[model samples]
Target: MLDCKPASTPIEANHRIKADMGDPVDKGQYQRLVGRLIYLSHTRPDIAYAVSIVSRYMHDPRSTHLNAAYRILRYLKGCPGKGILFSNSRHLSIECYTDADWAGCLDDRRSTSGYGIFVGGNLVSWRSKKQSVVARSTAEAELRSMVSGICELVWLRLLLTELQLYKGG
Candidate 1:
């Protein structure tokens, strides 16, 4: 897919990817592609959410899942220079933002939670994963995401303090 057309976005907005959307695809191929995407997501947090979605169907991938994976590749091709850039900053305030889609999964009605941790206004951590427990309400889903973000923030704060880089608020 070296010469393939680039996609403007990694995924379609509000796209519901179900298990039975399309014909079955090769499991090995799908797993390999998703594995590579997962590795890439470590440094390309922009694609983390999309990659996580595609990785869900690795066990029994369908045409729809394959297409979603292709979209990520196309997105990467379009933005070859996209990657995290960390520079020295004087400020060290920690900020975290999190959100969740309540019952976003059509198959199992599970919500996906995501969070981003920023230190000194630079993104230092991020994650997008399906919640283990099904949330009862939108507020619950949001709280679940916030809890995950808080855990990460606590760990970060501890690490910064240990290194003598954190200033007590």
Candidate 2:
């Protein structure tokens, strides 16, 4: 990463990635690169969206698609220390926030949904995935995103509850 060049943005805002109908590349290498990026998403939330976008094209990636993935790696190289930091604080509250872009995917016309869950000012979980169904309206897309966020909340609640019970709460 240190030897890679930095990208101006993690992903191109105006660019839309789709299943590459173009020439195919080495399947093994493509999958390996995407897998690496997915692993990196565990700590680098900033690259999650970009990596998710490019990963969909892994079945038949072209030079353009590979370049996009490489750009993300370059960005990662420049910001190696970029990650969430948990502080030693007594505050133990859990909260979730969500947002969505209706018809965000240009190719399939599906919406993009994102969510972030935090506990005591530390981001515990986050995600960005395209909705399975195409939403007719922005409100509907947003509602779908809220549902995803709620799922995260439930899991986090259960986790925190277990921790509390272990501590004899």
Identify the leading candidate in terms of TM-score.
Answer: 1
Backbone clash pairs in model 2 (N, Cα, C under 3 Å; residues 3+ apart or in different chains), count? 0
lDDT of 2 by residue, 57-131 (tens): 877787777878888988877777889898966776777999998997777999989999988788989999999
For candidate 2, the lDDT comes to 0.83
RMSD of each: 0.8, 2.8
How many clashes (backbone N, Cα, C below 3 Å) per candidate?
A: 0, 0
lDDT of 1 by residue, 66-136 (tens): 99999999999999998999878889999999999999988899999999999988999999999999999
TM-score of each: 0.97, 0.88
lDDT of 2 at 100: 92
What C-alpha lDDT do the candidate models reach, one value each? 0.95, 0.83
What value does the lDDT take at residue 103 in candidate 2?
93
Residue pairs that clash (backbone atoms under 3 angstroms), model 2: none
